[model samples]
Target chain A: MTKLLEANNLGKRFGQQTAVSDINIHLSRGEVLGFLGPNGAGKSTTMKMLSGNLAPTNGQILINGVDLLEQPKQAKAHIGYLPETPPLYRELTVREFLVFCGRLNLLAGKPLRIAVDRVIERCGLGDVQHRLIGQLSKGFQQRVGIAQAIVHHPAVVILDEPTSGLDPIQIRDIRHLIREVANEHSVILSTHILPEVQMLCDRVQIIAHGQLLFSDSIDALSKQMHASSLQVQLANAPSVSELSAIAGVVSVQTIADSTFRLHYQPDNDPTERLVSLAVANGWQLRQLVAEQHSLEDVFMKIVQREENSKDA
Target chain B: MLNLARNELYRLFLSPLAWVILALSQALLAYLFLSHLDYFMQIQSQIAAIPGAPGVTEMIVAPLLGNAAIVLLLISPLITMRLLAEERRNESLPLLTSAPLTAAGVVMGKFLGSFAFLLILLFMVLLMPLSLLLGSHIDLMQLASGALGLLLLIASFMAIGLFLSSLTRQPAIAAVATFSLLFFLWIVDWAGQSGHDDAGWLGWLSLLKHFEPMLQGELYTADVAYYLIVTLTFLLFAIRKLDNERLTG
Candidate 1:
């Protein structure tokens, strides 16, 4: 896959404070890269630099092989950016604002009209297309914001917290819309929602304190922090000491009088041994289920580890 | 740049503030036009007896053009205050900066947008003087000269307002700053004539000094050049400020 965007050694400093430092990132066509970070972790700064809204103090940005600093107009033609605040004008109607945005992106005549129409339809903004943007609800305003970003159909789309302030259904709709956007354009979305990454992103980058702590596929992140475990509930359970004596059980955590969590190595299958032992001891087994590590667990672990190293 | 300009013009006309300013300005100009016409009629017989006495053009039209200039000076700041400042306040500037637009293009588009609106106001006021063409001998040549000078003056004023707007995110601050700077330049000639034996460069810098000659239907290249240079300087300042914002953001 060809890289649609690339950044090397990106850094930004404001007076005495460094907003971003030694950051590198890349995106390819038809891919969704989730930028995950906590509030004030420099996610917006990084997105701003990547989208050409702010020039990096150090390093280079290349969009579709065009150098951004050297030929900003040409390079920026291939990028669509949606800032955190949605960047809307209160007076203009939804269609009018989209038309203005389309023109700014250098589209004119029939192409401009077609582009505006496409976004309005794709973002599901047909009902309020003639209403003033100020009069629309927050959810509709967010749709307008997304519509403007993709009107030009650039090679890359950079969105900052695209689903930040929406209801659950609106967020789901935006997530679906983002997936549709990713079908034709590479997307770099900055968000802290863990499930958003798991459900929509093909790859993920986690940043903390102006630095990247982890970058990999979602499955790889799960594997990096994976812990194999089993949840077992029996009518009558063995003591911790007796369970530890089981051949494949490494450790056991008691949840209640009849339920326990058993941790074991990947090389061993503890369920078979545990089932046989339970039958021999006349323990009526109620439930036995295997569990995999979730994205939240991995995110917390990675962020906590970074925080610990910084403290040290 | 034309596309951006068209968008700005569309939005400006849609704004209630722009319409309110337009209606109020025309009402004041019409009242002044009628009052001057009445005064000119009273002095008609006195002027016929004297040699090369002042005509209606001198007594009525000249002062009216001068009033138009003052009106533009006062309202140009309000017209241009929201050009770039409101965009920043609304956080919509990124849409332009991140597009395939140079800083110069964005500034030029905004400057021209507000400049075009001021021209509309100028044309509407010109209609009052144009109505007098049927009743008496109107000095078309002198009227043209005054019109030219007012156009140049408004261009310069809009440039200053646009430049000030680029310096801050608050439209109110930009309006106040622009008014203060233009007002100071309007009165700077008094300081030179009051105390100094020679009215030097300070007098030259006075906006009225250059504008007064043109108002009398005297077209000097130096006066024209002064307006052009001031317009270019402020426009360049606005473009430079926008460029620096992209760099430092």
Candidate 2:
């Protein structure tokens, strides 16, 4: 796949305070890279640098193989950015605003009109196209923001908190629009919503305290959410030592008078041996299930681990 | 650059503020023009006996245009206040900054947009004098010179407003600061009349001092250059301010 956006050693500092530092990120054509971070985690700062809205104190950004610092005009031509506030002109009608944005990105004549029409159609802005942006509902305004970002079909689209103030239905609509946009352009979505990343991203990067702490594929992250323990309930009580001695059982904990929680390696088999042992020893098995871990648990674990390491 | 300018003009016209400014200024200046003409008609025969005396262009058109300049001085800040400051306040400046444009392009586009609107106002004011050509002989050359001076003066005002707008995100503050700065420069030459030292340089620094000569049909290259230099200098300041914002903001 062609790399549409690339940043190396990207860092930004405002006076004595560092906003972000030593960050490296890249996106390929048609890829949605979710940028996850807590509030004040420098996500907006990084997005601004990548989109060329702000110059980095120490770094280089390349868009479509062009150096952003050396040739900002050409480099920015390939970038479409929707800042956190949406960057809208509320006085103009939706169609007029989109046309203006199209022209700002260098689209002209018939192409400008066509791009405006296409975005209005895609973003479900057709009904409100002639209405003033200020009069529209929040959802329609958000659609307009997304429409402007992709009006010229740039190679890389950077959206910062696109669904921040939206209601649930609007969030779903915007997410759907983003997914459709990902089919044509590489998207870097900066958001703190974990499920949003899980639903839309091919790869996810987590940033905290202005540093990139975790970066990997969604599948790898899902693996971290895999269950590593088994919850078992036997009608007839059994000794803790007897449950721990089962093949592949690493540890055992008594949850109730007759229940035990078994901790085991994912690759090992312990359920079959425990069941057979229960049958032979007259320990009646009542309930047995794996304890699943949610994505939030993994996120909290990662963030907490990073904090602890920093403190150490 | 042209696209940004067109967008600015489009948004400007969409709001009621531009229309209100246009109608009110034209109505006020038209009243001033007709009154000046009324006064000129009464004094026409009295001045006819005098040789090489002033004509209708001197008596009616010059003062009307002079009043028009003052009207523009008061309203130009309002026209220019939203150019950059409102964009910053509304957080829409990222739309321009993230586009494939330089800081100079953004500033010049805004300047041209507001300047074009002021030119329309100037043209309408000139039309009042042009209307007198049907009834009597008016000095077209003198009228043209005054219009040129007004043109340069309008440009200088716009550039100053734009530079000041770039310094703050509050459009109201931008308007107030622009008016205060322009008013000071307009009357800076008055200090020389009050028996101040270095009167020559103070007169040279006054915007109205440079503008007054051309209003009286005296078109000097130095006066033209002074307006041009002021326009260009403020434009450069606005561009530099935007570039600096990208670095430090």
Candidate 3:
């Protein structure tokens, strides 16, 4: 549970426009932290700063307790970054590029070759190891990109839109590969794909409009925005005020004539109490159930709240 | 650093563009000699006709090498235009910049790779002097000096090209800028001399003039220093530009 990376008050600006502002993020070892954001939301910018490709306009980045700007070589030693496009050379064969990458990471002799072989095998690039990179499919090329990034055996692997421009099967395969890799290295994957974060990432940080809205585990995020709801289907229509007056019932909304919904406070399981009250009132509770919160619902609610705040 | 340069050199060797430029330049240099063979033979015959006359090779050898240096200048921008420019265009500079290698290493490695290819082109043309001319007065030291001068000259311009390539992602733009800057330096030296007494030291800017004396057998420290400084300046410029890009972009 040690902190692997930290950025304090990190910011970036292009002339008059600020790409990122007042952002602070920290990651721990073996944590697959998903960076969820829309296009132009500064996900890529923040990642570039962390990976040593772009410097922050202001603030500090520490990798394994080392200041990035002060000791860049050491700071970058623990990071394996695959930019949005993978930064691959189209000319070199897969093995050659990886060998060069291993050397760039200062690996040589046995360890270098071992590292290259491990990553190439791990990335499933063994089939095309001798093929020119430009000749590979988009998925294969991305795999090579991932291979080169992790060839140095860094502590953290940062991928920007790793699943972008991929078919569903390829996306699933890559996501599975990411999960496998996450067992060893802390993963920071920047993606707008909701399912990618939900399925592969352990925690998610939602960024929008150059500001971080929230960062938490998927379960915690759902609990925050998803108010517990009591889904009751009555044989006949129930008065809104009647349902609202029920104990543990904070409010009532009508989804349909016979189906009424109840929003209640957190930690209060109102389904039993509501059923008791319905029995007392002789209301026909044909369907009485507890609603489960989904990640999609949570994401939409959080996004809506931000939009509301912007309007306010 | 070596790995990066090795990768760059591999790409240079594999690129069809490099071979196209090589073959094309070889033909041009050979033809430059072939078309003027009669004129050069006439001068050699004149020197031969006179007893104990200075050999034509001694007088025109440096100029011919300088002419080949000019060929280097012309074809180099084409070779170097893609070094950093295309990398930036394809968003590959970050791959190199983010690695453990420093900015200086990247620029120097690329410059050396481009210079290596230029040296190959110059070496390929050595047969021209060997097969065509029957002179027994070939000074091995002078030939080495001429090749060294051409290498130094090519290195200086390659540095300039490397710096210019870092300036833009558009290969055409970088190539044009390199040509314009080198062309200005080529004519600027003569123009500086034509300006009479007022324009002092402006003539030193010309790479041609500094390399001129070294084109002959004798090595001048000043010329070596001049080329080295220009090489160092442009290389430092490229490194600084790369560092700035990393910091701000």
Candidate 4:
């Protein structure tokens, strides 16, 4: 896995306000890295710095081992960026716009034509190739935006909120196209959609309040989503101390006269022992289920924990 | 840079704005050209009676070219207003900024794109003077000098428009600002004429003052240098503005 892009200690300031700071990120070939953040969390700012659209106030960015600040032209040749607004010339047709984008990335002659055609086919823009971009539907226009970003076959494709304003079906189609694009090129997508990161990204970086709070593989994030507690309803429930005495139960909370919530470690289980004790002691167990945590819960917990640590 | 210029021309021609401007200007200038020619013909014998009177080139072609300059000045902002301001407003400037291009490349590409269109308009206006060659002998050198003057003048107009365009995100605002600046430079010579000797600097700064010499069949390097300096200065300003945007945006 060769690293196709790298940014170290990236920071940006707008006059007296800081937009982003101490941000480090990298992407390897054939991998999709999701940038997860809330709105105004500086996701777009970081994307602008990485794509060479805005110069970072401090830090260094290397695309394909070339320093962006020292050799921007050479380094930016490997970057294809789709800004939040799509950066399109609405007067030109889809095909014409893509060809122009291809030429801007230094493609020409047969190669430029071939690259434009390949992107149009890949992005499902064949039908609207000759139609004016402004005349097309929003979905088709977004597809044109994506097509132009990939037309030059750059090594790194940086998309800022690619599915931000699309309908559900259009989002599905765009997601499918992104999945296909990830097979050949490295992709760094900034989005606030949790399910989108879960579905498409190999790794996720969670950013909030202009700082990165978490970075890990998606598997690790899901591991945090595993069941960590149980809700139980029992006739003639045992004492809170008695439930706490169970081998795997970490703590006990009384929910009601006949119901209790049991906390336990993910790898440890107390369900079997509690059930046997209920049968022997004649304590009737009515309902018992593992409480599952949603990804939203995990995300919020991580963000909240960071805020708490800062407050301390 | 050439590729970007081609794209600019492609977009310009694709819209109805450029075609409409071209057609309207050509028709209005052609009407002015023929009417002036008509007036010149009626006074041809009276002018021939006077010794060393102005020729057909001075009476017809020079004023036609002068009118062309004013016509282009009114319309050049329309062509250049969208060059950068509209792109920034639409948020499409990131496309060029993110590409492997320098600020100079983008500025020059836009400059040349609109410059090419204005040059075409200049050529069409020159055709009206060239048409007089069939019946009467015209001063080719004066016509050439006047054409050169108009070329430099419009180039400076475009540079001014381009620089102003880069300063804002609204096309209408860019157009109005460019017109105000160019119009001020055009009329600044009036201040010098009305005032004392100290107002010579105002006359020197007037765009029309340098342009007047070339329109009168007088070609001076100093006049040419003034236009060149104005054009280059504004172009540098535009390029610097774009580079600063990348840094501060």
Candidate 5:
């Protein structure tokens, strides 16, 4: 797959405070990349530079192999940005705003109308297209913001806090729209919500204090989080003495009849042997599986691990 | 470039602030035109009585266009202040800046939008001249030249306002700064009368100096060129402001 965006040594500084430092990233088409960072981790800064809203204080941005500084117009044509605030004109109707955005990209005549129409439908904004943006709910306003960004058919779509002000239902709706857009457009989603990344992103980059803590797929991230292990529940219970004898098994609890939960080291897969032992012990083995570690837990454990290491 | 220009025009027209400004400017222009014409007529009969009012022709044309120019200068700032400033405040500018259109194109597009609104305001004052000199030999060529000069004058004022507007995201600050800057430049030339030749540099630099000769139906190449240069320079500066905004915003 062709990399749609690459950042080399990307950094931004306001006065003496550096917001981002020595960042490197490569994104390909058809990938939904989550940018998970604590507040002020430079996620928005990086997205801003990528989207051409702010020029990088240092380093370079390459959009579809085109240098952003050398060929900004062409590079920017490849990206669509929804800033942290959604950059909306409250006075304009959603349709009018999208049409204006279409014109800004120099798309006009039949093509502009078509692009605007396509985005409105894709973003599920058709219902409120004629409503003034200020009159729309936060959910619809965010949709309008996304519609404006994609109205020109950019290859890379950067969303900063796309679901920030949204309720649970609205968040789900917007997430669905984003994933749908990602089929045709690469996406960069930045937010502090870890589960959001797990639900929407194919790959995740966790940033903290201007540095990346980890970058991998959701499954890989959960696997790499070795400190915070999951507690598994099985319908077949091993004898109390049998459970205590299993190596690397810290403890086991018989929460329900014929049910046991085991806490073991994350890397060691003891589910099979435990089940086999239960079978040998004449305990009917019904279910034996390790609970998946949530992205939020993995994220916090990784962050805490880093902080502890620093403290040491 | 054209599409961006058209969008800017649409944005301006759709804004309630734009209509309010247009109406207010039109009313002000209409009032000033009639009042200036009344003053002109009141002094017209007096001019014929005097053995020779040294420069009656200049006197006839100067006050009308001069007062009209003043009113436009005052209102252009309020109208043009929202051109780019509002976009930035409303966070809608990123949509335009990220477009393929050059910054110069966007700036010029907005300038035209605000200037078009000013044109409607100017159109309201057009009748004042026709009302006063119905069938008299009112020198239509002079009238046309004065109108051309006024248009250019307003265009430059709008450019100045737009440049100031681009410097900030606050519409109120943009409006106030544009008004203060334009008004200062407008009257700065009058300050020249109290000083010697060495102190007249500021007056010559003032926009009023470039516009004064045009109001009298006299089109000096230097004054015309000055206004054009001022308009272009400020417009270019406004474009640069947007270019920097992409980095700083």
Candidate 6:
């Protein structure tokens, strides 16, 4: 698959303070890359550079192999950006706004109409398509924002905090819409909501203090943090020393009086040996499930580690 | 660019601000037109005996167009203050900047859109002068030249207003700043009267100093060039402002 967007050594500085530094990103068609960062972590700055809304202080952006700085208009044709606030006209109806956005993106005639129609339907804006944007609910307004972003069928869609300020139901619906949009376009969705990233992103990039902390698929990220770890609950358990003495058990941490977290080597099938240990010792295994680290845990650990390194 | 211009025009017409400005301007101009016509009629016989006395074009049409220009000075700010300022306030400027449009195209498109609305007001005001054709003979060429002068004057004022709008996100600030700048330029020539030849540059740069000769039916290429220069200079400033916005946003 061809890469639809690429950033090399991207950096931005305001006065003397750096907003983002040496950022590199690549996205292919049919991929959704969740850009995760804490507040003030330069997520929006990076998104702005990719969308051509702000010029980078240093570095380069390529949209579909076209240099964004050298050929901005040609490169921007492949991009659609939905900023944090949605960039809506409160006085215009949803349909009118979409047509204006479509025309702005260089769509015309029947194709423009078809594109508007398809995006309206795709974003679930049919019910309020004719309503004025200010009259729509926040959920519908967010849909309109997404609708305008994708109306021209742009190859890359950059959404900054697309689900911000929405209710839970609205968030779920917007996430669903994002998934639908990603089927056809490369998407860069920036949010601090890790669960949203886990639910939607094919790959994830975590940024912290203007630096990249983690970049990989969600599964790969999980494996890196929780390799061969299991959470077990027993009716009658042995001492921690006895549990650590198991053939495959490398370490054991007490989670409760009878529950423990076991860590072992990746090549070792620790579950079988742990079950046998529990059976031999009459420690009835009530639960012995392999544990996958939550994204929040990994993210916090990465951020904490970065902070410690800086402090040292 | 044309698409943005078209959308700008649509939005301009949709807002009540444009319609209110149009109505109030027409009412004020009509009052001035009829008052001047009546005053001229009251003195017509007295002036008819005097050789080389002024007629309807000089007494009625010229001052009426002159008043129209002042009214335009007041309202063009109202029309143009929202052109780009509203987009910035609404945070919708990114929608344009992130599109496949050049910064120059966005600036030119906004200028054309605001100028188009001013033209509508100019045409309606011109109708007041053309109504003179119903009664007595009027110097049609003089009237046409004055009308062209007024168009250039307003176009240049709008360019200034567009530049001011580009500077601020507050439409009110844009409107007030535009009026302040235009008013300053309108009266800058007064300072020239007390100074020597070294200060003559003030009078040369004053808006009305260039506009007055055109009001008297004198159409010099220099006067037209003056208006064009002012319009193009401010338009370039507005375009640069947008370019800086994209760079620094």
Every model's TM-score on chain B: 0.98, 0.98, 0.91, 0.98, 0.86, 0.97
Ranking by TM-score: 4, 1, 2, 6, 3, 5
Q: Count the backbone clashes (under 3 Å) in each candidate.
A: 0, 0, 0, 0, 1, 0
| Candidates in descending DockQ order | 4, 1, 2, 6, 3, 5
Model 4, position B113: C-alpha lDDT score: 88
- Indicate the residue-level lDDT of B163 in model 5: 98
lDDT of 2 by residue, A63-141 (tens): 9999999999999999999999988998999998998899888999999999899988988888999999999888888
**Model 6 lDDT at residue B138:** 90
TM-scores, all candidates, are 0.90, 0.90, 0.86, 0.91, 0.85, 0.89
In model 1, what lDDT does residue B218 have? 99
Q: For residues A19-136, what per-residue lDDT tens digits would candidate 4 score against the true structure?
A: 9999999898888999988899999999999999889999999999999999999998998898988888898888889988999999999999899889999999888899889898
What DockQ class does candidate 4 belong to?
medium
lDDT (0 to 1) per candidate: 0.90, 0.91, 0.84, 0.91, 0.79, 0.90
Predictions' DockQ, in order: 0.71, 0.71, 0.58, 0.76, 0.47, 0.64
Clashing pairs in 1: none
Model 3 misplaced stretches (Cα beyond 4 Å): A225-312, B34-45, B49-52, B130-135, B193-195
Q: Which DockQ value does candidate 2 get?
A: 0.71
Q: In candidate 4, which residue ranges exceed 4 Å CA deviation?
A: A227-296, A304-312
lDDT of candidate 1 vs native?
0.90
**Which model scores highest in TM-score?**
4
Q: What is residue B154's positional error in candidate 4, in angstroms?
A: 1.0
What is candidate 5's TM-score against the reference? 0.85
Model 5 lDDT, residue B164, Cα: 95
Candidate 6 DockQ, CA atoms: 0.64
Backbone clash tally for model 3? 0
Least accurate 10 contiguous residues by lDDT in model 3 chain B:
B54-63
Report each candidate's C-alpha RMSD, comma-separated, in the order given: 3.4, 4.0, 4.4, 3.7, 4.8, 3.8
Residue pairs with colliding backbones in model 3 are none
Which of 5 and 6 is the better model by TM-score? 6
